[model samples]
Target: MSFNIALSGLNAAQKDLDVTSNNIANVNTVGFKESRAEFVDVYAASLLASGKTKVGDGVLTADVAQQFSQGSIQFTNNALDLAVTGNGFFATVPELGSLETSYTRAGQFKLNADNFVVNSQGGHLLGFPVNPDGSSASVSLSTAEPIRIPTASGAPTKTSEVDVRMNLPAGDSYIAGAPGNFDPDDPLTFNNSTSVTIFDSLGDSHVMTYFFVKDDPNTNPNEWMLFAAVDGKPINLVDDSTVPPSATGIIGGNVSGPLQPTGGVGGARLTFNASGDFISQIPTLADGGIITEDFTNHLPNGADILQRVQIDFNLDPTGPNPNEPTQFASNFEVTALNQDGLAVGRLTGIDIGTDGLVRATYSNGTSQPLSRIAMVNFANEQGLTQIGNTGWKESIVSGEALAGEAGSGTFGTINSSALEQSNVNLTTELIDLISAQRNFQANSRALEVDNQLNQTILQIR
Candidate 1:
């Protein structure tokens, strides 16, 4: 009996030492939790035996409980290294379509060959689908899916309209400086000229130049001719509302076709009142500004010939305060000039918010919301069964896993570019090691004393 009791004590002490050593060994492991060995004393006696002098049997190992306390965070340069702040775990799967999952605090993640976010062991990180407005589509665990970043996004859009706002030099000041005629090559024929970049269906850019020429004061008062050129080639304007859709424009009520560089052909007309205020337009300014610049015969590239660009000059008396073009006495200046178009874009960068929402930016000045990281928590964290790789699986002892977005409700916020260090404390484990060693020594001495007493008894007999 003494031998059995001493043997049990030695076993219990060895168990304690093993637990302490494991804790010390994994001190630097990320997301590692320390464990403790618990023991209970055993005793057995018949009901009839004297209760006052009862002795204990021995010590028995009860449980090896793991400590799940929060660990300190270590920041890194990688944005995918995530850490849970208060409560929650990062859900991961072995592959892309596998429903079987493992929960972990180790968030060292990177992109695979296919651009799917995966961990060091190739476990895919799960996330929730996001709406166009950057909100999670669903918070249920059933809807969580692997996160994948698009390598490229966004499509090109052609230029349809250009808002042009400028102050045309008053009266003859512009005409006086250069009085010959409207010649783009000479720069003296037109009073003022401005150029804007426009995009085609294929995202090809071309220069659209607008030349403003003061009309002959003798033919029409307070009138100016508007001529346009695309890619340095003169383009014709037309009013489809006319009887036969007469040529491009009407100068002083006369229709002309292709505008000539000598200032004698087709050119849109702008009429202003004696007070230097815009009042009317020739060939009529359509409901939404005039549209007549046609690329039917002048596009250099293989762009669609039917595509036409409209120059919007709100020639209205009551148009929004700052939208209409003014013929002020100031120097020729383009106050506002913008085109509605977009070129094909390339992926630029990605940003992850504290709420685990991912957004990607493009080179075309556009941003798109990708997905929201899924956060999961268990009712009984200690009841989860360890599955290695610093991950755990839901067991019967642990309740069902609950999924939610980070920073929502009681869920902990995710820290990107950081990792959670091991929770084991070296100081405490070293002390435990020393104590367990002393216990082992004491148990060994007891076993030796019991053996000596038995030997002495045998010799005396």
Candidate 2:
């Protein structure tokens, strides 16, 4: 019985030493949780003679409980590296195994040659996949696919309206040298008009030119006589009467003079028809409107004139004025402004939130959620059977698993670009080692004393 007692102490001390050694070995390991060995005293029971209590037999291993306390976080420069700020595990699918999903607190992730984000063992990080636009969707991938970025997107667009802005040269001569028409330094001497191209929903082009021959150039800068034309035909858009006055032009608006003038005086009113022809009372102003000084293309309604034209039509068509895109039945709002109405983006980096949301960013100032990671928590962490490689498997005693999002319920948030170091305490381990060594020595001394007593008895006989 005494020998059995000493042997039990030896076994218990050996187990204590082994557990300490494990802690020290994994001190630098990521996602490693320290553990403590538990021991139970064995006892013999007699069913028939029940009196005071059963006699003690020896010590036996009860269990090894893992400590789940969070470790200190260290910052890492790698964008894919991660650490758990709170409580949660990173889900990864191992490559060589059955590709079964496993959870861990290690967050050291990296991009492979193919650009797929993966862990040290090439396990892929699950996430929601996104289309060209930084939108979310429920998509799954077995193998990590390289991030794909697009150059441009195709959107609905057409020539809608044109904006005209320019400063006409002040030094100018109308009709060569018409009376009150020549001034080199004074801005009140010339007339200014502008033409712009507009496109309909069907992409048809139209040229709208406003003729502004200063009625009173010296007095009214804002109060100019405005004449409008389309193609080469005179268009009385404001009133629609009296054949736009041909060479005499329409006599309307604030005017301090007449339209007709002498030769070389360059007082001309031009009209452009939608059919792309320029009818001139005189040629269009060379440097007074939207066109270039040498521009001979007076008609603004042509395919060639709208090669780079973009258009946005207002939907209200009424007060809002500009054309609007036709709305779809769904909740999506469609808008048009240029070449393609689609927004642009480029791949920048990736991130994983505590809730297991995989996000991707782009150079075009866009972001998208690719996927959500699933987590599993066990009822009996101690019941988990070790499978080496810092991994554990489900056991019958561990109970069913509880799976949910981090920071929600019992699960915790995950920190990116960090790893969890082993929770081993060297000071405690060293102290425990000393105690075990003393106990081993005392047990050996007791055995030696028992042997010496036997030897003395034999010698006395």
What lDDT score belongs to each candidate, Candidate 1 first? 0.80, 0.50
* Model 1 TM-score on a 0 to 1 scale: 0.81
Best by lDDT: 1
| Model 2 C-alpha lDDT per residue in residues 211-298, reported as the tens digit of each score | 4443343443212233444443333221112112222222233322333332212223333222312222222222222111111133
Mind sharing the TM-score for model 2? 0.58
**Winner by TM-score:** 1
Candidate 2 CA-lDDT value = 0.50
